[model samples]
Target chain A: MRSLAILDSTLREGEQFIKTFFTLEQRVMIVRLLDRLGVTFIEVPSPVSSPETREAIEAICALNLRSHVVAHVRCVEADVQAALDTGVYGLNLFFGTSNELRSYSHGRKIEQIAHDAVPLIRRIREAGRYVRFSAEDAFRSDLVDLLTVFDAVVDAGVERIGLPDTVGIATPRQVDRLVSLIANRYPNVGIEFHGHNDTGCAIANTISAFEAGADCLDVTVMGIGERNGIASLSGIISQLYIHYPDLLAAYDLTQLVELDQYVADCLNINIPYNMPITAPSAFTHRAGVHTKAVLRNPHAYEILNPTDFGVVRHVDVGSRFTGRYAVGHRAVSLGLQLTSEEIAQLTQALKERAERGSLNDEEVNTFILAWYEEKGSLVWER
Target chain B: MRSLAILDSTLREGEQFIKTFFTLEQRVMIVRLLDRLGVTFIEVPSPVSSPETREAIEAICALNLRSHVVAHVRCVEADVQAALDTGVYGLNLFFGTSNELRSYSHGRKIEQIAHDAVPLIRRIREAGRYVRFSAEDAFRSDLVDLLTVFDAVVDAGVERIGLPDTVGIATPRQVDRLVSLIANRYPNVGIEFHGHNDTGCAIANTISAFEAGADCLDVTVMGIGERNGIASLSGIISQLYIHYPDLLAAYDLTQLVELDQYVADCLNINIPYNMPITAPSAFTHRAGVHTKAVLRNPHAYEILNPTDFGVVRHVDVGSRFTGRYAVGHRAVSLGLQLTSEEIAQLTQALKERAERGSLNDEEVNTFILAWYEEKGSLVWER
Candidate 1:
């Protein structure tokens, strides 16, 4: 496992979804947050889009952060020049290469695309900036043609080559095989994998690409990007930390939820309640079987403690799945105690309320206290 | 392309996320909606879980629809008995088979699992119910052992074998290769792919599995299930409909957004505004360039028209990217004729308001009308 490399694309892809375009100051704050979170790269906007976008990129570039700032651009001379004008540390030059794009969308020959991309990549590198030449639809492109395009860009002095499943079509095995095949053939070429969530395979494909010898991963905060979006930065970071701890350095994982919420607020979008890691319910337990185990040892049901990410654990008593153990634990936390028989009676009442789908935490506590009173074992003064 | 067989797990998996558990009535409504939408299978809950669940499954089984009502059950004789008592049209028999599950969770040997599964499968077959055998964590299990477990279940009269990436570890290529390998070797056995969204590969893996000859694809409404959830029913349906229209038939695609919203409301979960297809912004354009193309031809920026999914195309004039095309389109819609200069002026005002992040639809229209009045274009008599 290699140390995880987080590339924050909030400015580039996340801005695409905002009803209101971000100002220079807002872009500066986002870059600061990315820096605070110790992200490896902060992807700014395509400088060719607008003067405002270019200003925002320049503002981000002015920030004194350890993280590198990169600008996205189409694989053309003007776009490359626009990106260069922002003074970004690195450049991501992308273009459509698949048949769907070449024949149906761009109506350009594959050779023409290579010709347009290679010289621009050489110019960017000659200017002393890092360059990652990307094939926009590499997954759907012919293997021979993809190799030829990458070879041309790499020979033209591009430091890295990125293969993007621009349409979210590639599978993990295909990523692994393609990345490995390319890496093996071109020993000096650095590889980066850019994936999308159109088919929800982004993260899996990214990891497989890493295993296949890719040096870096392209990700976005909350997976905000085109269509169904890309692999989530938080999801990938947490997984890498937990499963491949040896390969990656420690990230400011505790800041993840806060970062997500900030972005959500900025974009005026609601993060789904069940979104992994950041979701309110992700750490909560209500099922009877799960609750029992969780009450015994939270590790039984939780992959990691909620507090690890500075989130609170919620004991939800909203259904028949809510167990006696959870109820008893909550009562104990409230400094109450009950005998076995009283606890069992309280459990039965709770179950009945839950069965009706109307149970709440207060109701469950009320029933527990009433049971304790009836059994003459009430520990509270009241 | 093969016709995609959608196995809707709304009842079995979707119910897991709700704080307010579904009543028998709500379950029936969901089943009816799914049936009307022409899903191939509707997975009802385990009868052993509750009397209400059993009642719901029985009621759905009695419905006169093309969809088969399949009851999900643990691979145990008692669970099978409960399922049989409900008279469900089909059985989804599932069990854990990975070393982690066998050693740490269930403490059962692989041989014991095969032994236990075989008799239950045979009994279900003897009872004349269509049985789908699933090896939980099949993705992590050794290939030989997994094959052994699947072979035994298949030979014991199981109608289909479900290969689940229980931990969401399989890539699309892995899914394709595994399913194709199984299909090639076990020509008589039907293959079903059950995927999770842990690493967010569920949809791609499902499609790959389909291409690899899998007979059924397991999905949940809004992708609700354990952890990060399962493959999204709406997403899979839309992908199949758009990309492989000849593969399936009779689905009322327009009902998709309505059905998804209905389920989200019942589950008390807010649908993310960025959710594909059903999201508010999915068809709404704020970018100047996109709005221009949309005004001339909506298909220029979108593959499927909004009306096709029971949604209206919205031109949101609340971004620096909002241009004259959006203003002109709105003016035309309101039966107003404005000069190019007036449209440009209004567009500039909208962009300014958008820059401040305070723009609204009414304000945009107000500004446009005011601009028309100033230019002597307003005809109040009409």
Candidate 2:
């Protein structure tokens, strides 16, 4: 697990997100953030895409970052030549293999694709750049075609091969089986997983690929890419932290939240509230049962420790569904002392008031204080 | 596979999301949406949580919606009694079986829990309401203790046994094995999966459980829950649509986007950008390679058809990553007549201009037209 590496594609695949247009400077900043997080590779757009993209790749490469700067390029001559000119650390060359892509998108024969990638792979390697060949839509491609292309590319000096769920149709089991078969076939070669989120299994698929012996995985900030995007940087990190914490020791986990925030801001998109580890409410606890359990031990309901990521836990005691335990905990934190019976009574009264309308934080505290004075006196009279 | 059931917990677990405070009217509207979407079960917060929750459950029950209204309740006397009083269709009874939860959260031994749930299960069944016994944090609970509690509840006529990854720590393979083991043990009993997204494996776990013979799955509108949330309703639907399209024919797929939006609005949270079928950009395409393929045939890169969800495909042609094919597609769609060579020149010029700043839709069209007139004449002269 510790040998597994990450390729953060926020600069390359992320540029395909509907709203993303990372200015050259922003691209540089993103690379810096990726380097700080200790990602093994930072994939940028192919220089052939545009003049600024070429400049951005050069600028990022010039930064002398620890992470390898890889450029995503087509196997076409112009794209390969442009990538070589950029003098990046690596080149990720891709060609469509699925029948849908072959017949309609690229119109290339299987033999043509298998033979064409050899020289491009050799060219990148000869230029002192690491090379990876991805059979685009590999999940949907013919097994024979995929194996043929892999045989040619591996024979040519490609260091890694990408298994992309280009259409996001593969199930976790399918991904596991496929990646294991391929990883076993080429044990010495690196296998990378690039999954799309169309079916909402990107994180799971990535995990399956890794568990199946794929050494490299592709991720983007907020999973931002074409359509619904791919596996997310924060998402995979949280998953790895849960399953393989030792593997993430080199990563600056604290920088994840800021990195997610920066990309979301740059793209003018919201950090989705369901985004693991980095959402504004990711560490906030609500609901009576959950809040009560969390009050006793945050571990009762939470697996991800907030403090580990430079955040804190917030138990929302103002909800109508809040428990007496949570309410009482809040009261005690505010320096109020109440018996169990008194706490129950106040909690019931608060829920009744909250039924009509929600109470703010100050109101919850004010009500607790006011009830302590009014309801406490009434209880004594009783 | 159409026999598979969906338990939408947006009203129940979603309430635990820190930002969610669904008003009574909003809760009713959400229930209506779920009913219209044809989910088998609509799980709502237990009445014991708050006075308003009791009223909301009753109000939803009064609608006589086609979907079963299930109340998520603790397997305690007060909670069970409150759930029965609400006259909902079913009760999803749960108790902590894990050591941490047993000692700290609820303080119930395994035997006590095993014994206590039988009576509540019998009583709920006696009240003409369906009952489900969910061993909370079942992933962490001892297998023997789970079997014991589940044996008692199953004997007492519980309709379903929920295998909740309550702490979100189970891997997909772990979930699959556990679900298979339990499903094999209780051949007649129904199995449900309630997973949290803390590890970002909720959707995959649910899929694994479903694959391993679990008939029911727990999901929220936006995967919103205590921590980072759970499997998303849209996510499961999208996955099923891909793997088992016949199972989703009964579903009103078009309502998916609206349901997600309605819930996000109620909670004042943004819909996750990677939310499979509901996010604003879920159907948008921007990558040059992707757009080119999609323009030739949407199926080339898209698994989920936009028309199926009442959304249109948006091809973004303003990015520097725009390919000549994409620009040409845009030109043809805009009724501009240009040869391939002219389109290539215009694409090159567009990329050069977009390098400085991204162009808007109108600007992109204007640039294409200007280049076609200015540079097209030059091409003819050459």
Candidate 3:
């Protein structure tokens, strides 16, 4: 089977998230954590951005962590030298190729971009470090322009070709086709995908790249990066766990919780409630149909096993539409005994009361206890 | 061009979210708002689920809104009658076909499922209402079994066929292939896609199905539903605005901010920062490279136009990574005159001070004003 390698960019792309500003210590801590998380690589911003940035990269490289440390740098000589000086395992060199970025961000023709990138790639390779040459805003770049750069960089001994959907505008179908085209052209070179989530397709686009033979995928914690960010490590891994479990054999998937928590704490934002696998409701079953089926067998509703991710499934039976099975389960869990008839009646009562809104466990238990009180001197237990 | 329709499932699937419990009036208001937003259909829970659910459906129907109202119901006759009784414009009937659900949720043979569904679908059609037959957990269902049931339902005159990625296991490629297969088999039937975000592919899968000839796409306000929810309305629309503007021409896209805010308020959760379109950070540019380019041309980095969604782009220059151009722009806006040299020096000082954390505008300005004080009695123009 082909490999699906992760290059976590929490320190590089993630630092670009508006709310994030990683300290030197925080950057080191993140690199160490990512190393333990078994990411194939840990990407950091180029050292030239600031003194602390340079120091952080140097400290990270000195850690001798398992994950390779790569610095994302512009296709400029000074930037390349600064990154090389930091002793990163490699450098991710990029030049914007999209007409908009070319006109506004960097005034460079597509032809000239590859020429500039080639010497840098060759120098980095001669320095005994890996290098990836990315045509930034690649999805919008002319296909021929992209291929021309890839050819030049590959010939210059670049180890990987990075295709970034800088604007996050590429559809999964579009990304799949493009990655497949590039993968076919450069069968030996690692193809890395860095997709933004502006369209909420980062995870899908990353998976499409993988399925289409792209070997390396870039991700951040909570998909944190510029604008809507890129694919989250947890989101990507969760989908992989569902369809390609073998790909994650080296991963201690449970540690994702700590990683996610650390990043969320750093940003001072709660993990999005709708985040896959790591969100508050990723494993919570509340709808009657879901709650009933899940109670019968969790597989009936859950694709990702919560326990495997160091999270637990919560079957909330206090909702208006929750079925009698969930209500009975709730009653039993609350140390209340009731006949099937009583459970049905209690379920009806709770459903009606929940019309205004759902009840909490305490409210549900109180109602169940009240119903049970009429039946007998029910002994309440914790 | 083929028509792409929307079926907003906020009332039906969104209410199933653990934190959501729409009161009768709130449900009515949401329905009215969605209708004004120009969604083609509004899906509500089966009227038989709760008294308020039924009342809300009746109230919505009586409003004479342009959007079609549909109720999601089980394949049972009583559920169909309950939906029909609510005067809904259509009924969405579903039965589990996945092995896990077949064995645990509902112990029905594949043969029996269609046999039971066809008669109910026929009855709903005879009632002169639109009828949709959804194969629940379509992704995991045996293809032959799903096709067999689809054949029976289509033969029974079903207006639409829903392929729900129940438990959110389907990849975009898989959904595309499956939706294409079904769409080709029944060319006249409207194909609906209802994908869950358990693995963060919901938005991509929904768009994939649409691209693959699925006519109807289901979306919630924030993709809120059971578990991690489904595709968000704003997320789907943002991607469409970027790549398939024609598909969304019939809708008022700017109103998405209100829709997202309403749902977030109802759920008592913040709009996720990574959410596209309506998210607070969606248009906030902070990275120096991004801020510089965006100030030069917003399109350089942004795919979705913020103003199109009634949101403004914010170029924050207070952070360490912000470029000198942003600082200069801030200086200009703050009515401070600084030469290029002065701006660069101030930029350096600010970058050094911001290593501990990003400074607010106030803090950045304090340093800016202090630098100005040293230069001269520079009449700071606001």
Candidate 4:
């Protein structure tokens, strides 16, 4: 009953951001990497954009990856036709519907917009391809309009419906209510959630969507996309793996970090050190008290061992919380041992040094060994 | 009325995650920086932890900072005594009550835990100091229990209550629901939202909490703290300044990027290029189409002008997307001009070079100028 599906939109949405353009070969290489990583779906470019997009899509279709290759298309006949020409495995048709978008940006009435979406869904479905219709800006759209569009698309034979916080404005409560409403009203259709990071809520909204019974999720590698970008693949996958491990069974959890690093390198972006599970600091410890507790029992601070994702727990002594265990461990590494009293004195000395912001490994070891020598309990190896 | 209140816990929660020990002077320096940055409150260390904390808190209090200094204390009698002894401006008392915490960690009855939080709130209130009672695992707590605990605290005269996603698990929907529930129930009380990034929903949760009527937010520079850390100050501030400018009137939006860079350097951590507002790539363009559009109109792809944050747009041409605009701009910058048709030809040649991943600025400019010269369009200056 559980499935792990990775829907990658690097070529379509990721290309939209930054000035780094990908050629047919680079695009093909990105797809190849996703396939090698065993992603469930690779979202290729919109074929309507340019001839280059058409060529990129056709080249990817030729790869015959075990993973499905989907094409992103606007909710218009012309765009859907372009997608069909690319021969993608599925079609992800999207359009805007928020008040600001409907009334100001697109200058279209909600009723007219909903009507426009239905035919596009039908056209894609009639082509015998799986269709996922997205209500762009759903977070800001009126509930009545959202539900009406969802109902229309479902009736039009859309296999899946995606609700996007195009401007990253939806909170988790809204996501819960909306997803729950759709799950209740359209039990036969798959529900997906696509989010932006305009307000940095992409991950939160996506998770809320899942809790409310979303069957699919949209994510970008390293969160590379427009504006603040989309929900990061690592962020969503780690959360699911940690809190809802039973929800996704096919993913190789161990390869998660590797896959993220690979994609980050390909994108030529440095991963944020505080980035959820992949950052170096994610598992490293430096404070004295926390390190002592960790030495006694790692569960004191570590929820999951960093090694689970191929990372190691690093204990640094340069912080204000340097603990006894970290100090003792450093002493051991330096080939020195002393009585508990001597160790206590060394700890106090190290604390003072840390307070002055002048503490270094060499200085710490020198102080520790000196204390041991003064106590007449020193044991030093060559 | 709108207010901008910053709650800084660099010495408390932030110190908890530091791998290196900081001196008392360094602690004071950070507090001074906070005061300089016009932070509303600074959360000092737990006095019960060690002599250094007590001394640092006492010293910081004596400095009489414009920003109020507070002590973080656990929901216990001894901890409260320790905090009171430090003579801080406020107390932040916290405890856990979620199923995961109560059953798996605390091993205490929920009722007993809830009762413990009330007395602590009363104790801080009776002492005539400001108080913020945080539900440590509020995100995962049952709605009934969460509401009951908040009601008890409010009835006991607690002024502010913080709803924390202690393990970084809540989505935006959950954040909005919790904030709305508390705001609606305790109309007069202050509600704060504290989020973690274990699930990468911290920023979104903070914004949702604001929309749901939370009065204050908890953030850290570079999102540094325990585990996946908390919501980033820069990310939240930039989003607010851009989309909800009216919500934070007193905050100096122009100082945001500079402040972020300063914090990163002080912490000795390099800012990630993809970090929301302050990232290098945040305003850099490298693709052909985007560069062309930007050259014609920066607003074509950019939502906000980079100069608003004291940054400028840069167009790099290393990737396959490097188009005619990049080439033409370079040619113009080199004091060379070609006919429109000749520029188109050179653009095509540059695109081919970019696709081959070997385009250099010198070589590209040389090829364009040579073609222009042969066509009698320009003469070489040197």
Can you list each candidate's DockQ?
0.24, 0.74, 0.77, 0.25
Clashing pairs in 3: B335-B381
| Quality class of the docking in candidate 2, CAPRI style | medium
User: Candidate 2: what lDDT?
Assistant: 0.87
Predicted complex 3: CAPRI docking category? medium
lDDT of 2 by residue, B1-382 (tens): 3379999998888877777778888999998999899999999887877666788889999999999999998878998998898868899988999987997688989999978889989898888888889999999999998999988889999988999999888888999899999999999989999998887889999988998889999999989888788999989999888888888878898888889889888867777778888877788877778888888899998888889989888888888888888999888877898888878887888887877767878998888787767865886899
Please give each candidate's TM-score.
Answer: 0.84, 0.96, 0.96, 0.77
Q: Return the lDDT, model 2, position A336.
A: 90
TM-score of chain A, every prediction, order shown: 0.92, 0.96, 0.95, 0.87
TM-score of 3: 0.96
lDDT of 2 by residue, A31-133 (tens): 8988998999999888877676787788898999999999898888998898888769888999999999998788999899978899888888888889999
Q: Which ten residues in a row have the lowest lDDT in candidate 1 chain B?
A: B297-306
Question: What value does the interface RMSD of model 1 take?
Answer: 3.9
lDDT of 4 by residue, B1-382 (tens): 6565778776776665543244677778777766765678888777866777788899999999898988877788998988987779989887766766655444567678668877777777788899988877787788787777777888888888888877676767667777897888889888888887776878877877888898788887667777667887776776676668776565545566666676666667666544666766666665454566567666544556678667777676544456666677787887986667766777776655555554455666676676677656444433
Clashes of each: 6, 0, 1, 23
Worst ten in a row by lDDT for model 3 chain B: B373-382
